[model samples]
Target: MPGHGSNTESMETASAIVSLITASVAIWKTIDAAICSIKNAPARIQHWRAINRLLQTSLSRMEETMKRRKGAGLSISERKHYESIREHLQCFKDDLEDLQHKIASVALPRRFGKRTIPRQVLTALEIKLQEDPHLEKRVDRNIQLFQLSVALLSLLDPAPRTSVRPILTELHALHLQVSDDDDKLRKWKESAHDIAKDAAMREIGFTSSATDRVRVGRQPSINIQPTPQRDFGIDENFNKEELLHKIKVTQDLATRLEEAGMPTIASNFQLDAIKCGEQLREMHDHPLDMAEYVSLEERYILILISCQSYEEASFQIALNRLNDLASKVDDTSRNELFRERQTIGTLYAKLQDINSAIHFLRIALFDGYLKQQDLLAYDAEIRQTSRLLYEVYECSGMWPDLEVTKKRVRDEFGEDPVASSVEISKALGWCEKKGFTVSERDRQLYFNPLTNENGRTSLHEAALDPKMDMDVLRYLMLPEYYSLRDDSGDTALLLAADRSNYNVVEMLLTIPYLVHVRDRIRRQTPLHRCKDKRTLDLLIEAATRRNSIPPGTDWEPVDINSADCSQRTALHLACQQGRVDLVETLVAHNANVNATCLTGETPLVLACWAADTAKPALEAIVRELVSHGATWEQKFPVRRDPRKRLKARGFSNSDISELTRQPGSSTESSEVEKDASILMHLDS
Candidate 1:
């Protein structure tokens, strides 16, 4: 009897196994036919086909196993899997039917305007397919059409809406529908809740551009940003090639992470991302922008700062660090290299902290760097800093402060006013690069009320400051301002040339009319105020070129020998100041070697008369002058013993000379005799 009973159970289990395998095959055939009918689907629909194909593989594997084991009594696991499969097939029976019916319409003739079906059911099927092996355990055999709809809707939402909201809505609807008594409703609703949010988020991952509205979820584990491009704005201050390289490396890491499965960018890509992040942090802390490697360390310590807040914390931190830097330099000097302070200040301005921006701007204007700079190179620190300062003030409606900032610029350019009281920065140059234009507000702020409270024009204010932002200057600069001199009789060229602003000098020299523009005091020309050798060379070269002046126009190049009010020529000033380079440059350019000042001192004599402290430079200038045919022969007496008359002529004797006599032979004696003869004649 026991053997017979066991045999009956075995037969029944075999029948059940065969029936489950048949049911799985039947549904898989339905899905396979639907997939075959849908031809050349769009990417969105193709995934539906792919999931169905994978499902067919799972079903085929199951059927083949059942066939091999047909008539064998079911093992514990096998019976469980057999029941699970039967339940899974029953749960999705309607979904498979719906897909089978809809897919033929998708495959309809093109002439019939090709029909389509909803992808929600396909997506839900795909989601369940990915969770295989355990599918039977979780498959709710009594799943209703509404439960399928809820799950399909969750997976369909590209934004996924929110993980909690949709799940809550489904749960609430299920609660009202079942009165909390329907266990199958409860069972399937829990199952939907488990997979819906995650499934929706995964759907979003497939669409990286989707907003990923899963509010409480982690940062979308996928990169949604499109590839970085090379198009850059003026805001980029770092090396562009390096920036691009950094971005590319980052992108490569993201690609690797995505290629592997990820919770965080998986496997080696996670490592790469971590290392890259570490490298970025290291770079953020210590920027290494060395070309030759000689100036590597400490070059870019504070050039950039990242801020999360717009309030004073960041600004204050930056300033304190800057002060710490200055303290390292000197406990009391209270200065950083201008580039450092300017970066922090510019960042403050970007963050819209006006006062902090102004404060940093003020701190950045250390007289050390600016005092040494004449004509700045393109993109010089001072130029950028000043531009930022002007923008900050103007944007903040601090016109008075903006105007006051124009004075801070005054500190940047100072050549010697020892010979003339003209402010070097106030005398600036402006011409244009071809086809450049500035807005009207830029013109007013940069170039505006014609003249300041002092008689200096907007052009004067523009001169040293643009630092060679030539495009705007091209628009702002016009011929009217060329001849407009301030009360001090300074032209922009005179200012630029005076500052030895090479770029300004080079640009201003482009306009033929500006080469010889002179200042009122001492009647000195740009040539007279030019203290830099390169600038002097440029001026001399420009003077030699033909002035595009019309044949009858009174335009004439200022004579290389034109004298100032002191009767001092450019060469005379060069020699007098013991500027060996300037004197060499001038002499080489054919400046009159024997040009005399109001006191009748020749270039050789003036050079020889340079202070004993300037003995070496004086010797060099004397040699340069003499080599260019300067003579010691003085036709006039020592006009009031030059040194004695210096103090009375608004000159400082201490600054000019500590007179020293030189030992000489007969040639010098004869010169002394002539000097005595002139003195005797003056006495008579």
Candidate 2:
């Protein structure tokens, strides 16, 4: 009985604290809601700053409370409640930080602060609030937790008149305010719903009457009577009309939000509308004609894609509905049926069901051709399907099947033989190099394509495979082929480098002219992409062919520390990718481990920040950098404590030439100085 009494007392105290915290959070949320609706730009920002200040105060208060309660003989539940409160406070603080950043970016007009926050920014904030459920959910949680805590406290505290009165009063006030807001929202939603429904009905009625003639005949009707209502776990008070109205209002709101640069918020509202629409369609007594039902299913698919709602259950439902609709269409409408199948395939692909995806896409091609006499007529459709299938094969690493698809696609679309022939030859060479069976048709084409504008030549594709054969590559060894740059300016060597295909890199290195070639878009060389030790070594060896310079010829070797458009060196990439072996190899080859990217992220900083970097591996890499004379004290001078060290010290933006200064000045020293000057200007 004594232990029971003590437990009761503990719970009561916890409940009181929870209730107080809940009331405070609700007030915070109320202010946030007001800020969301504020029209004046400067006033809204001022309110956000005030709210941010409040959050910081709340966070500090919670931290102090936590420290005071460290050994305060609290129950497990009480401790948990305290921890939850602290977490919610911190989350609010973080969200406010983001909100402040978003607000700061919008330019306010020179006119007096009388103008409403730019219409666009207001709309964006509205959408942001709608899309992110965290604000609403957090408030709701706080209310529930506080209410529960208050109840517990009331049970334990006998002197409730003094101990619980203020807490109860605050909580009641918050509850009333929240309920009032809900009522206003519901009323607005209902009005919007009615207007949308009227407009939609008028349009649908006109379209239906014009396109379809009613047949006067005796209709077969089922005499089935209604049984008990099917629950489907839906709310008993759920109104069909209300849901319809909400869907319309939410969709319109989302569209406006999206147009105003609040895609995330818009997406959330669209998702909400879709969920409502789905429920409306699934109601047992809902009246939808077959065509209308099919259209609704298609709409669901579109909305899901719009919202990026890639959850498997939603996709599965859409796929099932599409399949059901496809089953009803006759052979005369096989094109429609093909589209449904293709949609199903694409959805399956998104779900990572590769076999099912391939099966459905193949069915689309076959059924459209066989049933609708659509073979060459739908060649474009088939080609598109083939492209998706090829991507799936490549992603799933079904290399043989990828080769087969390539051959089949080129052969089937015979209208463009010249282009298809070149593609087929290239594909064949890649397949031969990778030891995937090359089609017999491809063997006849002896020469490679003259130009690779689209970036899919045989050598480039083959170089992506780690096991590419020397014999297959011999066919592409002509001087022109060896030196060829694709549309992206990527040579075979660059492709090999990016993939860490060691064997392929070794073979490609035979072509001396390809060693230092950079891609067109990023201007990244083979070294920039290489993250494997052996592949990097091969690239470094090719770049540093001192013997090729011929004694005292005065030609400098290639710059191993060459930077890409982003100023990222091979060391930066290696460190970023957590490639310890490559990192070591690159440093050994005189790669600048201290090199800073455009963002001022050094190799040490990158290695530390890499999401996948293992603790032991990171330690080893950091140790390697330190051994090679990296001094974080000069660049990232932070406190000795590990936790303090891990806190993001802002960008170093150190002098680049000094950061990457070599022991011996090279011919490219001028370029480094230019880069350093540009960086300084940018920094200033």
Candidate 3:
């Protein structure tokens, strides 16, 4: 028993020893594992701390620079710096993330006891080295240490219970500040780009105002500058001239382009410019000399006078400039200046600026005569201009100027010394002093048989004038000039008769000798020439006087119904003119109404011809003709046999009707035989 007991005790002691050894080994392994974890914890925590510090530093620098740059107003250079910083910050963040990943993959397993540490003491020593900086009284280092400690504690199975929430909240706040600063920087950079583009646009003369840019839908706008070739000169006068020249050049270019078969897009503007230049030139060269410069000035005035609207505006401005220049010219240059003034006045007249034109003309006239001491030559154009000025001034109620112009005209031409309101007898006396002669025959002027451009006597012009004065007519109708004829063989009587001049007609009748005169048309007497009531009455009175001859008078009654060419008598003309009164008067005087013309048309046929006449007159004439036994029937001439009545029926034997039945036949015959007999009888 003792041996057994001893054996059991030995077994128990052995068992206890084994258990103690096992427990010690276990404790050793556990301590070793804890030490390993603590060792690896420093490296892991150090890596996390470095990564967090790097990330925080990068974000802090970025945020601060971004804020500073935004406050400073970012320029292009500053924006580039911000972009660099952003790239660097992104790279730093990427590196930090890489480091975190490396720490997690390589160190976390070993520190958590899943693997063995490759270098325990080195990692611990590194953590100790990092701790010294924290311990050196640096706030950032201290923060890093705090963060590292917290990170390591989090990895521990029994982590420290102390709250890390406050630290996390601070980090979050920093992140938010950085984010806001980045946003501000981005906005600043964009604005700077826009401003730079606008400046560029302004430099190009592209009207880069904000409103205009917006209107054009420009974004990130760049300014467009005008090309040097397109730049117009700065001087207003020069610009106008340049524009004119450019237009002219453009027109020429356009013409060339058209010749070349190129499009005329650019040349059209050139043409407009050329026209403007021409107008400006014209306006610049105003009043021209009539004697030495009429032809050129006339053309210039014509061009200027034809302009319309805005084109005319330039012309007006040029004219004003010319006038202004003229006003400043010295008086010694008055003669030369007067020429210019005359030209200007002429232009103004053409432009319908009558008052201004007249004003200049009067000044010119006065300068030519009074001041310049030169006799102003009488010219048709000058007289015409002066006359127009007078009329225009008169209509505008500028009577003083009108009178002045009229006096100038009279002085230049021959002045009429007779009083304007003189009596006819007094005027005649004045005319006698002027060597004017009067005739008791046709009341017309007797001159030296002066011929006009067409070789017509001057009296022809007077006769052609519808408003010719009776006194002039009387003065022209003297016996010595009664034989005068125009180029058209029109005598004074023919003219007076043609114009239906009643007063002239009566005055002409006073000359009994002219009553027997005829024109070149041959035998066309004044009585034969009457077409109207006034001339016809005069002719009738003359005829009656001739018919009621005085005692022992040698005068014989003239035939009033005498015919001329076409065998038309005075009665035919009267009827044709629808003159009922003249016709009745002539008919009462035993005038022949049935007189046939050369065309075989009687007065009755002429009266009924196509014209508007009084129905009563036509009826009376017809009745009188009928009462005179005039027949309406027309008898055809017998060109065939005179003894045979069948010739009047216009049929021969061959032309007889082929019908067997003849309802209106006067004689009976067999059908075929009757037809042949009728044909033969008709032929006979």
Candidate 4:
């Protein structure tokens, strides 16, 4: 008792597993002792017995799993969890044992070979428990912890071997019933008409009617009321989460049973859950708001999906009912019908029923409007709907439809990336949460190479966005994606560097040797394409940390001075067109500034050609490269003076024959040396 709840942190997982089982057996024996000691055990006695047995059985199921999991080796967090459970169970064992000892001390007259505890002893104990609110709360908390521990038995196992869910539901109902029984017993004990009033007959071994007495001959029965089924009914303003949670709970059971190879038994449970949703639907006969209507219908739709993978009958029934309900409301309730279309269409899309998705989305967007031709008439929701539908189209390779959605939002809705980012928030998750469960098949869409123009994964595209967190990226990674190039000849990292997206460059560099992954045409490494010094440093640092390339990958780790096919390194790209800060950072990191490209141009030659064309920062960039030990002197350097032996034509540009990509490749205006350059001319 002195160390009632102490030293749990010192306990190990194996010790916890042993101690928990010991404490569980102790608690069971204590409950049984308490049950045996009652002279005229109340109706609540059987409830306590049920709960005690349930806990014992639940603990037994957990024991094997806990041992197996422990054998598999516990993580630090797992060890701590079991230790805490051990400490709690030990404390619960102490509490129940204390109560049992108190009951045991109450010596009463012997009856049927057992010493009974008087009703007054239990009454006093109950009163003591009542005086301390925390004690009762402690018991409930222990039960909940036990519930959670049993729940853990199913941790990675496909099915839970334990019936903890339905058992807990029954335990909860029984607890309330027992609590009410206690209140009744307490009330009666306070009255003059309790066991104390019937004490004279106790000498002759007469038992109280508080329990069902076994008679010598026939059982007495009058008309009996049949027990009622589980009440799944609702009152006004019912808890939506509670009612709807039935879908998850029942489906959970069915899934477990199926996992246990009892699919025939499992199949009925989803149908049972759908039937409950139908009951919930019936209860919502009164008028409802749009959010409520959407919420209920969404749950109902999920119920249909759960019942049968694509049970056409249920879908048609819900569709007809919704249409009938819409008709009853008005010829046109735009908000209602639009949301219904969005909800159902999203389900079809998520279900990968592309044709149905496109059809319903068209109805949601254009059907209600008289001017269906004009996208300007549609609202922001239509834009959201269009985006969702476009994903479906894109998934199915329906390029024309995807283009139409994109064009509609852009041309009519004024969906500029910069402007529309602020205007469009994500649609409420009525649909997002409803689809795409994780499986290898579902993951195939993500990890598989897309057959379309961008060729499938937009991960390359996502990497270019400054805001995207590429850390969760490994979940979407496949071996092919490691070197996968988009249609534009960019690996995800190449795109990051091209854009000078510093954060994305930093993230991509974390993949060993992936920092060196190059684009197809320029064969330019990320280091080659990058313009900023921070990106340069990131790539250089990443190069040193390379490991053995992942198995099955032909990717070779690159040197810090590695060049693209044109033989230009990151330093070469930096000197000519890069900012003064970019040149300074590359130099500080010990970049090889004297390195020449395939065109025989040094960093100093390019810098000189780029400098003092009365160019302000250009002269500074040229000076920075030379100052960083770039010997364009070939030990002596010259400026825009073309009279030098080397004509240095490409110096104004990146010396393209030995070129690493300069920052702007796509746009000619941004490309500094887009035109064919004249050889540096000598003048008299």
Q: Each prediction's Cα RMSD?
A: 35.9, 25.0, 50.2, 30.4
> What TM-score against the true fold does each predicted structure earn?
0.30, 0.32, 0.27, 0.29
Give the best candidate by TM-score. 2
Candidate 3 has an lDDT of 0.42
lDDT tens per residue, model 4, 1-684:
322112222223555666667776776676576566666556444334435543554455456555544433332233334545556666777777666655556544455345334463565456546655455445554554454344433332323222222222223223333333443322321221111112212212233321122223211111123245566555333555655676577666656644432332344565556555655656555323444455454544444443221122444554553444334333545434666667667766534456766766666765542225565555556656765665566445566766666666456445531123212222112112223222232113232224234453445655656665433342333335557776777777778788888876665554445775667787777777877766766766566442345556545567657787888877677666746766665554445766878877776666656543334465555545433333332323323432231234333443321122111111122111211110000000
Query: Against the unseen true structure, what C-alpha lDDT does each candidate score?
Result: 0.47, 0.50, 0.42, 0.49
Cα distance off (Å), candidate 3, residue 557: 9.2
Encode model 2's per-residue lDDT on 140-218: one tens digit a residue. 3333333323332222221221212222222322333333344433332233222222222223231122111222321
Q: Which stretches of candidate 4 lie over 4 Å from their true place?
A: 1-453, 469-480, 611-614, 635-684
Model with the higher TM-score, candidate 1 or 3:
1
**Candidate number with the higher TM-score (1 or 4):** 1
Candidate with top lDDT is 2
Winner on lDDT between 2 and 4 is: 2
Question: Order the candidates by TM-score, highest first — what do you get?
Answer: 2, 1, 4, 3
> Which scores better on TM-score, 1 or 2?
2
